[model samples]
Target: MPPVTLKDVAQHAGVSHQTVSNVLNGHPHIRPTTKERVLASIAALDYYPNQAAKALREARTTTVCCVFYGHNPEDISDPYRNLVQSAFIAEAQAHGYSITTAFVNDDADLTQLRQRFLQREFGGAVIVGTVLTPSQVHTFQAWEMPVVLFDHALPSTTNVTADYPEGMAALVQHHVLQGRRRLALIIPEQDLGSTSIRRREGFLQTCARAGVEGAVYDGTWSYDAGYRAMQALWAGESRPDAVLGGNDRIGAGALRAAHDLGLRVPEDVSISGFDDFEFAQFTTPSLTTVHIPHGDMARQAVRGLISLIDGTESESRVFPLSLVVRESA
Candidate 1:
């Protein structure tokens, strides 16, 4: 079938296309009964406004840049990152906008990207993942361009982030409530971003409140990191009764390491993770993890940036994470 248009709706309603437009745009001159008829016709025809033509007439550029500050192009393959990227793309396209992706590997690359952004190369930008340095972040703060920051917390900026503290606290509470007093947390060796920092803060505070013993181990954002963190923790004279990973990737690694060391999950030790990635549910005993709303966050980030570009106010939004209980914990 052909695409439904304003004219089609107008014809079905037995009115001019301009009348349909007037009704759709909330023009007050139209009668209530007439508006009802036009709306009914619209519903029947399933007509949608042509955003592409509207943007063209308004002289609005439909291109936005999604910059990954501290990640390599290869990093986009990670499940969390992949989900966010795909979601943003779909949402932007739905709004008749396009996304251009750029990767900033280091400080030098970040500086150069800033220069391009200053030239008005994009209608707006969504900063995803992480940043390389404090100065690089400062550059984003001082820029005149409309931008949305994701996963990072900064005053006076539009941000979209998950409730990391609450998620981490729930994980800690789950383990401690099950009578696991001694715990270990495995996190990325790279500079802990705002999300990681918040998670750590929650873990520490919750452990203190519950009178549980917990320790942090540094590792990468990968399976090896979880594996190595567990190995290092076991190298000591004692072992934790439970282990929590920063993300599912690390959690899966911890599970592997534990099995390799002849330990049983939730029997010898309980293990849980953040970001309930697909693999989390498929582990030997199904890992318990935190479920972050990645798709929703991506949509919000895109909408916020578009709002900024349209000279509208968009406030920062923090979404809550849910705990997924499973046999691993």
Candidate 2:
């Protein structure tokens, strides 16, 4: 059968095509009874609006784009990205919108980036984990499209982020309570400029208050970074009794390094991680890490974007993080 059209609904409801259009667009001029009759006809015919047709009529696209900029595209493969993106997808679908993804390597051309978004006819954008250059952000602002930013600081654009400081403090407090006198923190060097920086601040402040000596190691937020940082710690004359990683991947790497060096977890040394990824449980000893609620953060980000699209103002939101205790710590 041919696709159902507004004309069919108009004919069935005994109204003009314009009346059906008004009802669909929420023109607020149609009679209540007339609106009901038109809606019933639409349902009876199982009419679904063609998005292309609606876009043509409204002169606006119904799609949003998300651009992620970073040193390595693989960084998003972390569990944090997985959870946030998953939530964003589900929430966008619920709001009758779709998302497009783009990547920008460091120092890419702004004009080229704009062309990509234009080619896709993106109605708006959500940038995740990318530190937008001031000019890039200005470009998006100039386009006058709704934009939401995540993980990076942007003036003028709305943002959603995790409470890294509080989460880090909790992790350190846990270690202190466990009687860990010498503590160390391992973080990706890249993260020193972002959320990881906040985590470090929390850790150090807590350590000072608790009077525990603390050290920091700069590395990648990966298993390799964690392993290397741990190795470096072992080689040092004064080793920390406890180590905290920036995220779960780093934590896992630290665990491997400890195992290889004949240090039993929690018995010989204590280790912990953040972002309770899927692999956190299966490690030799289950990981005690901070659970960054990615799903919840994603949901909030999408909701904020939807509100923006609908011309509703949403307050800046922060999601809470929790500590998941297991054998490693």
Candidate 3:
């Protein structure tokens, strides 16, 4: 992309191109009235006088920041975040750029990230596998660089995400049709970002529409977390006949929890999940799940970010989700 040229100021100022330059450089003895015309022209174009602005256009724009939020240091190893990031890295490498992992765990980390990137060392960023509170969102927006969000959406930003509501609705409808009136869901104790919230809301809405009793359990995005939630949900005498996991990993954990509690699969309680991960079909009874195309989303995010970095047109896109039925459900 080319920077605005002297022709821009000349178009309105009707002065020699050097006249605008003289005005900007604070040349002495220029008519104050004439200088104001060039100044006004610069302001109208929203041109930045800082060298950073110029360096931005001159920079190679070949590096991409890969940012993911971690609640704790251990969350840096989150499988879901890793898989999604790996996909982005692969695509970014294919596009002749390197991906730099940015682990953001707290406000201090976030502030440092924003400052470091403001140096324009990275062309843009792809933020995935995290929740952004309103303040966090503002921090990211302050980067003043192209960005693509995965599994989340924000105004004025490009986003690539699977249609969570569609997938959750399919899962809910499938369970309700099986005569499972008492359904329960296990989701991250946190909002888990827009995608997770969308799934939760979709389940609730679909359940209400189906006139079935639906309950939700707070759990993290792991099999162990799912296991604990299942244990707690089933401990009560009034148990749900069907349960949904936030993801396949959680579903697998829930399956084990049922077995440990002397319960049968499907026969005792139907189990299903989102993110039909590769091992879903290999689970005990196989796991029924919503297949979110994370790979496709990552590819789209990379493409969109590249387009923005190159000063081309890029629009946000939403991918549809599909439900995969297996024995577990």
Candidate 4:
């Protein structure tokens, strides 16, 4: 069958195409009875609005693009990425908007991505998990497109981020309350950006207040990195009684390392991580970590982007983080 169009609904409702368009666009000029008739015809025919044509008529794209750097097949396979992306997709669909995803790799030129935005005419953009270099951020600013950043922060751009500092602080205080004195933190390399830095600051501040010396091991944000960091901690002159993994993946690795080293979790050394990924619960000892609420963050990002697209004003909002206590800690 041919694609259903406004003409079909108009003919079925015995009204002009303009009248059908008016009703669909919520124009007040259309009579109540005519509106009902047109709506009934639309339902009977299973007519759907042509989003592309609607956008063209309105002079807006009505589509949004989500860009992530360092995200690939491997990254998407991770539970954390799936959670965040699923939330974003559901939220975007609720607003009658479409989402397109793009990946930026180390050797790939960003100009290609920029060209895509121009070709597709995306109404707005949301960038997730990408650390924007200063120059790159300047380029985005110059584009003057409505943009929102998630899971990271950038200068002069609207962003929705988890309360990393407070989350880490709560994790640290929890261990201290559990009577664990010496604390160690396994963090990703410094250049990964503000999220890690804020988490580290929170950990350090909480440890200082408790009068405990905090040791920090800098490494990548991966299971292998977490395993190596734990090994190095054990080899050190003094071992921390508790360890904080930057995220759930790191925390899971730390738990495995503890088991391999003949250390009983919470008995020999307690471990906690951030971002309660799905695997956190299935670990040998369930992970005690901070839950960043990916769904809420995605909802907020969508709300903010809708406001931006609709020319509405919005204030910057930060979602609160909660500590999930489980067996590992």
State each model's CA lDDT, in order. Answer: 0.82, 0.78, 0.81, 0.79
Model 4 has a clash total of: 0
Worst 10 residues of 1 by lDDT: 51-60
* Ranking of all candidate structures by their lDDT, best first: 1, 3, 4, 2
Which ranges in model 1 have alpha carbons more than 4 Å from their true place?
A: 1-59, 111-120, 132-138, 141-143
TM-score of each: 0.78, 0.77, 0.79, 0.78
Find the 10 residues in a row with the least total lDDT in model 2: 106-115
**Residue ranges of candidate 4 with Cα displaced over 4 Å:** 1-58, 106-108
lDDT of 2 by residue, 1-329 (tens): 66677788899999999998887666877798887787777767856455454344345566777666664557666676667677778888888888777676633223334544444456667777544567877767775567777766566778777788889989999998999999999985565355767888888898999999988889877899999999999999999999998889999999999999999999989999998888999998989999887777677777777778778886666678889999999
Comparing 2 with 4 on lDDT, the higher-scoring candidate is 4
Residue pairs in collision within model 2 = none
How does model 4 fare in lDDT?
Answer: 0.79
**Per-residue lDDT for 1-329 in model 4, tens only?**
67788898899999999998887666878787887788778767856566464344346676887777667755655776778777878888898988877676642234445544544557677777646776776665565566778877766667888888899989999999989999999987575677888888999999999998898889777888788889889988999999999888888888888889999999989999899887888898999999988888887887787778787765566789999999999
Clashes of each: 1, 0, 0, 0
Q: Rank the candidates by TM-score, best first.
A: 3, 4, 1, 2
lDDT of 3 by residue, 1-329 (tens): 56566677767788888887677665888897787677777656645444466575467668898877654546664567767878999999999998887877764456446544655668888877457665666667665667787778877778787788889999999999898999999997577678788988999999999999988899878889889989998888889999999888889999999989999899999999889888889988899999988888898899899998898978889899998999988
Q: Highest TM-score: which candidate?
A: 3
Distance from true location, Cα of 68 in model 4, Å: 0.3
**What is the RMSD of candidate 3?**
11.2
